[model samples]
Target: MSDTITWGMMLRKLPSIANAIPRLVKGMKVANVKDPTQTCGLGWSFEQATLRNPDGPALLQGEVVLTYSQVNQWANRMAHHLIAQGIGKGDVVAVFIENRPELLVTILAVAKVGAISALLNTAQTRDTLAHSLNLVAPAAIVVGEELVPTFSAVRERVAIEATRTWFIADQNTCKPPGIAPDGFINLMTACADGCADNPASSRQVFFDDPCFYLYTSGTTGLPKAGVFKHGRWMRSYVSFGMIALDMRPEDVIYCTLPLYHATGLCVCWGSAISGACGFAIRRKFSASQFWSDVRHYRATTIGYVGELCRYLVDQPPGAHDSQHGVKKMIGNGLRPGAWGEFKRRFGVNHICELYAASDGNIGFSNILNFDNTVGFSLMSWELAAYDHDSGAPTRDATGFMRKVAKGEEGLLLAKIDDKAPLDGYTDPQKTETVVLHDVFKKGDRYFNTGDLLRNIGFGHARFVDRLGDTYRWKGENVSTTEVENTLLKHPTISEAVAYGVEIENTNGRAGMAAITPAESLATLDFSELLAFARQQLPAYAVPLFLRVKVKMETTGTFKYQKTRLKDEAFDPGKTGDDPIYAWLPGTDTYVRVTEQLLAQIQGGKYRY
Candidate 1:
């Protein structure tokens, strides 16, 4: 091989470097102009986009194509309608809807009137749904017509008044049913006659005002609502939209992730608004139809989570796999092993791996398109040595947290101050649990991310693992305590311990539970238990593997011991006499984990 490069090769690289300069300049301008005092909210961004490109396409949902001005007007109409019902600044409006155009529109409408939109996760049921709705104490709630039955089932438990409960029609029916359910008014009919003028109240919303609340599973059985301030959304718009992805006005973004998540709501949608781009959305992700949808919409950019990427990668190879127009992707949790293969197979030009929590103050992005890294961080952050067993920061002799050396894994923490303050959760007491004081210096504070990461050099880091009682699965965070509480609710389940176990070829860990039955194993109605789990928790949180334990192990304090159970995992070979049952996909009941089934799992036959 020649040591020196040819002149032609050097000349070819010049155009590549030249093409990035304009984007660099635009990104710099966006960063410099991101002012907290400049009324930087989603509503402000919506107005600016409408003014800049009123005729440009904004939203694409199946047969519908809404322009910027049309979407703005729709939001305005909804805002006026909501204001007529006494919803205004400082008020909270609950939104319980699936991923639809109205979901984002309702959020914007709530923001336009200086009201906080509490985005309820659609996966919740009954008591969990009621807890989330009651947590915010909303002045009103907007429910999708398809979800009306679920909302109606828990209406009595929720505190929203009958007059304030509004129902938006689903895709199947643009109008509410002729006979509306009691205590629910049809929002479409009510807002059809409302004014389309922009509400003046949006001007009162400042940078620090709460804009949205996203649910995150807590240490308890219920989900804790995380505050998402307008200021933070503005930052993401500048950093992720303008800088990292460097989107343009003509770009069309395809987002299949749920809108309730920050990755979809703040990063994906904010990027579209910042660059006046178009968005093609889906109600939910489908691996089989992902590329087809991308091609149908002519999407130049796509959003994903690790699980979605794995699902797409697991599908059998076909001509359509590489036939889509996706040039760039922006998301978190793209596993290191799958990174190169995903890009190579899908022909993605850029992969901007990002890392940030809904309530955390700091974040990282792959601005330089680095491989196997979460890229650079602009804010002050550190990798402090942590206790893996206890899931706590390791203190040095001087009573200060020690930073891990480069390339070593440690706990990720963000310095908290006036500029990088943790927005925290709706429960202030729960907020206090995640904040650590005197971390490195006297009287200093840091926001604990509860995640482990490697301190890769050059300001970049690699995500290692999640700590404490929380584990991520299927792109959603699962709390061990929450699942355990639900499992114990069954009369036949006397003891239950929940933990996550690594599957051979999965994006995140799969949940598993070790339980001691109250009676003979044959007497236990596993199908009924599965039904109970499906009712009490989201599908992702339900344990996939169940170990029938002879007796439950406990610590000196009587706390359930998950260490030994986690070590043994779900492997029947290592579990000794204890039998393991697995909830196979598409199956109604639990089946014994036979050697053949274990081999199938190890060989990656099941696309779990």
Candidate 2:
């Protein structure tokens, strides 16, 4: 193979490059412009698309399609209704609905009336659900009728009056579920009498104003709400929607990811609206039905996370697996091990892997279609050497952060400025924790990403692990993500979580992996698993302890929650009946932990 750049690759990217320049120029002008009336909010952008492509399909679910004109009218009517209910600028309207066109309609309607939308996660229940709703202090909540049961369970705790609760019928028949619960108003009935015209309040919305509050995935406790500014939303529209994915007006996007998250909301659906393309949405992701849905919509692009891709790959191979029309795939967390096979099997030509946090100031994109890399960042950023044990940046004698050389792993940081403003959490104190000052110079401030990444050549970087997830074992740093990715390459292990465990006599934390095997508990080849892991990993990186779980626990965005696992830390008493195996020192294979061995291990007898 040639070690030089190919002209064919350059030719393939010319169109995206050509399309990005003008869009970026327009976005910068919008971001910097001061006039609230001139800056285009989400409502303004949608209205523009409606005018240009009135009859084009805006949203799709099965055979149901909502044209841009129809969606605009729906949003207009809902906006009018919300304004009549006394919702306006600065008021937060919480939205708790599933992935349907109405969900987008409600959020867009909230935006049209210059009110902020609080996007609530649908997976949350009871206290978690109530806490999220009350955190934003929403003036009103638009609830889907299908989700009424879950909402009703925590409705009293949310503290919002029944009069302010609006019920949207997920099914088209809309009989208001026979009896309306408490003071809830049927939004379908209300929308019938409302006007389908743009609200005057939309003009008051500005680029700098808070557009919505996206909650972080609270693995340990209640999630923190992060403010997302309209300015940043517009920038994402231009970057990911227009430049990165570079969808055409004729293209359709198949989005299975939840709309509550930024990747699905801003990147996938927002890209479709920005390019005036069709959005094919699902209520939730289904590994079995994914390809069929893609084929049904003739989708040219699909969105994903790493776990979703892994699920798709784990299913039994069939003729229909790669028979879809999808040509482009977008999103983050595509592991290097699976990236090649996924693209080849699915016939996808472009994989735009991105790196960004919901509330963080920095973003990196695989704009050049580079393999196994997060690609180059357009904004200014730095990589500082980090201490694995202390969980902080390693500093020089002068008290400044030490910069890591190229090809070395370090914590990623982005300088805070007007262009790259940190729209931190709703709590000011919580926001202060992520901002670092006087790093390179006095008075200079930067946003800490809390992620470790390798600075590969030519400005490209590969994700190593999260700050706290990378643990020290045997005087070497062990990246949990790396170990998990390696374990996932095995055919039998469907999912895995790698963390550190406190062995009685261990110098540092010992590597342990909790896994969900593909086969029955009796059929899993433990010896094969050990050999495979040993082949792929170094001695220090290979997990010493193996935990077989019936099912793995995950957060809303499909991230493994390691807090409980780390807390348990190989303690048989806390882990219950889950089987634990240990690779003893000088042993070639793992053995089941007996009662005596467990006691001995806990009593500092093992030299791990």
Candidate 3:
């Protein structure tokens, strides 16, 4: 029989066979690995792989290929130097560096010493940078020489002692003299005499021990440090790397995202668990050079964010566009519309779209080759209705947790108990705010995932929008993601953000959208774009007003910041710089929004 016939027959017989073999359908395996006391989790696995594949490629930087043995030796030497500097178990070491081999070496070294690593975002300014340092209160800070000015600006406000700061000089790059503070140490000088083969000397770390702290993107407000335990990090690797991406030891993974982000740290780092080589690009993502980099590094796999993917797809197609070796790509936030196009254009076989939060305990992955869904979770979790304005769980008079029906959107929560601990932030109050206790059953607890998700089917869920991003319109909740997705379907739009704007005499907030058109489509046909959105999105969800911008402001993680955009809604008088357009229901095209129109809308004369 032909392959197609055999596949068709197998699909037809699956239902009957599934009923006969219930255990197989439910994914119950008879033989499972029994080792429970494996002290060497992911870190030790990498060490073993490095030893076995010493001559094999471990990291590829342009034309430079660093073997596994070389990386292992450098990490060992760095670990010894760190230990000599009084950094050991339970100590918090802050890392502030870009995506480079040195950054990975530093992380591994810290882990070897049983010390917790706190990776700081290099994109943060003085105030936010100081906030991150104060939250962790690190024993020592290791900063890249390139980011010295940023660190120097915030050094006084950081809680760390002056003597604990260390600056890493990139020898290949220029060195700035007098950039380092008086008491700061230099990493090159400190490790100059350290031996590479020093014996490992550290206490065994448990699964519950804090491994790292990733700060949340402060899009809503101030950034909070989210503590990641060893167990959870390991689990993340298993789910994202092993099950989702199906990564193998021979696969070379390319990461352009910042290392500080969870997707880079947990997902990309987890690729190391498979003994795979990871290629780090020590610069911001450039759409033009993306394919060339992939070809240059011979990368078989790559990780991405939604914006990065969109940017790549928007680039003008070239003869060499599909002439790369990338086979599989994994990350979260790939919009449904661009999913198929990305695969077709890039010639990628697998697009593992995942869903997770930095602080939340629950996670989902696209394992069964499902398209447009964040696939089922292997662990337990729940979803319930959440109030946006109050920022709390909504309950009935009977004191029972109200869960959204199948296919409806609701807040995602993870069951937190002895088996699944809520390894929250250092602040107890912030931790308390995330825990929902005694909701469905007596003494049961759940970790509140602030984002909302909708059940798609087959144990899978699709990301809806963040709770703060969703707003009420005409007694119906409007999902920002849905509106944004609709707006993006228009060929002219490159990016879009949907948010609620307050209006006088309005029972609920009005929908306002900001759009950035493709460069080629700069002379936008607003009438056609508006019509497309109106047909796809619900009447109430359609934007009553639109603002055009050359670009949208986003966080380091590429998430659009709505707080600032919402504050500067289409008040033509206040926001005179950017052109504003308004959509009247009956009009074929959107009219220019002027000060007179803004006043009339505020006076309740204009109806959406």
Candidate 4:
């Protein structure tokens, strides 16, 4: 009722008007388009950059380099073959292959035909492989010859009536399994013979159409398939590739991550958006060969995950460590402890650390050269505190959603309106679970990203930990990342994972730590790490129990999943042969957790 306009009122109005102007103009342009069908999908982008740039390198694998024109021609040939084999629009084709030229070619072929390509994680075991294939119900499956054993194991469990199954081998060979009555084809032969006689199918495709389905870790439960629409894929190309990295058509991108993951598929493929070349690595990441490969391929840019960076930093400093042609690096999950060290050792000029999930609608990139922070978003989104136990947002007294204060950790949510569609998945039930409606404003929708992040000013955010990775200790919230960072500072520790375990009569959960010691520090003085952690972390945050592992289990994407480790806890009796240690409050070092000690602790006879 005051004459003076409050700052909050003025700020709110300004943002809405600011966001609408450009969007309104874009909407009008699209509405007035003379040919609406031509203004859709990757076809538009492909047409903009024709085959005149054919001589430019588009892909590099080892010593081989395929030009942009060659890549497009190969994809077109493959697409024609697929169409002849009864695989066209609306069909789901599962591709099980490693990082190779064939993988990229297959994905492009699938997209060209307006089909949904399900890129299956090659690292998945038989059970997970079966689950993934069953969920997709692909009309056809394309696999590498090396993964024949994997498909053989899960073939009985697959329910889809696949029309064709193909394998790419060293030599063009059609060796179909006995049970596969649909017949087998060889990729080499298929590409050799172009489908010139078959006419192109006439099907309606839109920007909102599903191009690919990327599966996320089922850490909460079972893995859910996340659909990536053509429009969202195009957006990644513009935002991350063009605007963020400012990549040029001549840039050579070194991609070591698996092609099945979203980071490699979207960011790496975004190089193609500018007609840039992508160098693919097939084998597991080797620190010794990392710089050599970069130098050999003359890669100007590289993509990485946190573990990849940590592994490189853990290696002994070589004479050529600082000698590399890599000018920029992009990807997510780079921990704060290794950020500066990685850049200094590798001599990388630009570290575009981005934060996004395979299923997440919201994304953040380091556009402003912010250190240890994921940069701001150009779209609409919100962050709110989420209940870990219930996996939902917390509501206030008036049933209104609460937003997290700046610098506080919260679950990221993206506004899903008509403009920003949440083309979730084929499974509607799984999709509904991630969408929240009528939160801050009535009739508004938001996509819940189950990640905990701290807003680090200037529209930047730093990923703190996964919601499940965080634990309550001594009535205070303890982030696993905070503990992991402190442990990494310990000279003896090589890798570490910190989680919480329920203890008898405990207020909430007690801290537990797992570590893999450096080889040189095998005979490490345990007192040093214990004393260091005690000085660095609070009393409640310091781990009460410890487990030493020679190697830690990680997902294909190199993310450490603590669920199984948390379930194993610190019971020495059940730990098989791995060493377990326990810390007594006043002790300067940790002592072995013997069977008798574990029994006593579980029986409530021992207190620490």
The prediction achieving the highest TM-score against the true structure is 2
lDDT tens digits, residues 519-595, model 1? 76877888888888988999999999999987876421133556668878889999999999988888888889988
Top lDDT hit = 2
Cα lDDT of candidate 3 equals 0.76
The digit string of per-residue lDDT tens for model 2 on 121-166 reads 9988898888898888989899987888998999878778677898
- Decreasing TM-score order of the candidates: 2, 3, 4, 1
Q: What is the TM-score of each candidate against the true structure?
A: 0.76, 0.94, 0.90, 0.89
Clash pairs for candidate 2? none
lDDT (C-alpha) at residue 27 in model 1: 59
Off by over 4 Å in 1: 1-37, 172-179, 218-220, 469-608
Clash statistics: count for each candidate: 0, 0, 0, 1
Spell out the clash pairs found in candidate 3. Answer: none
Q: Compared with the true structure, what per-residue lDDT tens digits does model 3 show for residues 1-608?
A: 01112345446646544443443232222111123444543456567667667677776666657777777777777788888778888799999988777777777778777788898988987888898888888999888877888888988887777667887775442122334546677765666557877336433655666778889888878889998876676567666665566566677788788889889878876764454565546467888888888887777888899889999999899988788889888888998889889989989877778887778777787665556777777567777977766557788877878888877788888898654568899788999988988888878888888888877655677787888888888888888888988888876778899999888887788898988887643578878877787789888898988888888889877998888888888887766567888876567788888888878877878666
lDDT of each: 0.81, 0.83, 0.76, 0.75
Displacement of residue 459 (Cα, Å) in model 3 is 1.8
lDDT of 4 by residue, 1-608 (tens): 12223355446647544654554454334322234264444534443343446577777777777776666667777788888788878899999987777788778778778889998888886888899888988999888877878787888788654447787773222121222223456665766668522124323456677889998865555677889877777667666776677666667788788888888888766645544545456456777788888888877888889888999899898888888778888988888888888888879977889987777676778765556878677667778977765547898887868999987779888898655568787699989988888889888889887778777664667787877788887768889999999998887889999999987765678899889887743666778778888899998899988888888888877877688778889987667777888887667888898888887777777564
Write the number of the candidate with greater lDDT, choosing between 3 and 4. 3
TM-score (C-alpha) between model 2 and the true structure: 0.94
Which whole-number lDDT from 0 to 100 does residue 511 have in model 1?
94
Ranking by lDDT: 2, 1, 3, 4
